[model samples]
Target: METAYIKTPVGIARIEGDEHGVSVISIVDEATQLSPEIPNILSKAAQELHEYFEGERRDFSFALNPRGTDFQKAVWQELRDIPFGKTTSYMELSRKLGDVKAIRAVAAANGKNPLWIVVPCHRVIGSDGSLTGYAGGLWRKKWLLEHETPPVQHRLF
Candidate 1:
């Protein structure tokens, strides 16, 4: 897999993939420099990510190939169906996956998602509307949710 980095509002993002498709797009938790020469596939990912962070694009339209088990792949694909700015409880996700009893497993798969903004694992929240576990850190998760959410208008009565 070819890897490249790009600076995002929250942090440096590392994108990886080849002709097959994008395998991973993640925040570099250990810090990395942007690629001086970006590959074709990575360039498309970086551009879409930049647009996503800029709030100019709500959904991504690039090819993806996240590596995971069959169950995990199912979970990730379901995550993709989640609309931008919307939040789903782990229980709801588990139900969607056709097994509410697998909520914990569903949460586990969600946590293991390799593609960051592309997979949108951050959209999962607690049943009571509270933010929950995010591998990229809660702050970044909050930022992404806020970024996707439209501004709340105030009424001047």
Candidate 2:
């Protein structure tokens, strides 16, 4: 596995992965350099993330290989299906997975998602339309949500 840290508008982001794909992308307070040998996967992920933050890209084009259990993988897959400018609730996701009772589990899986924005985990919210738990701080989640929303039109006076 290879690792590299990047600075973004929200915070420092740590990226880790290998030839399989990106396994983790998390926010932190400081940047850390990877070993002198840079893996192709980590380099690609970093480039894609840079494009994403620059608003020059919408969907991620790089491959992902997040590590998790079957259920967690399923939940992460569902999160990836969420469109860039949309949001869903834990209840909605639970229902989509065909088990409304699994809200807690679904939420836990969402919380454990390692791909962050690339996986679109920030699109999920509380049932009452409130921003809920995010591995990255809720403020960062809020900013991400706001950033994805379409620009409002204004009329000239």
lDDT of each: 0.90, 0.86
For candidate 1, lDDT tens digit of each residue in 1-157?
Answer: 7999889999888888998889988888785777898898778788888898787988888889888999999999999999999989999999998999999999999999999988889999999999999999999999999899969899989
Error of 2 at 66 (Å): 0.8
Candidate 2 lDDT score at position 72: 96
What TM-score would you give candidate 2 relative to the actual structure? 0.91
Tell me the lDDT of model 1 at 61: 82
Error at 90, model 1, angstroms: 0.4
Q: At residue 78, give the lDDT of candidate 2.
A: 90
Clashes of each: 0, 0
Error of 2 at 119 (Å): 1.1
| Cα RMSDs, all models | 1.3, 2.0
How high is the lDDT of residue 43 in model 1?
80
lDDT of 1: 0.90
RMSD of 1: 1.3
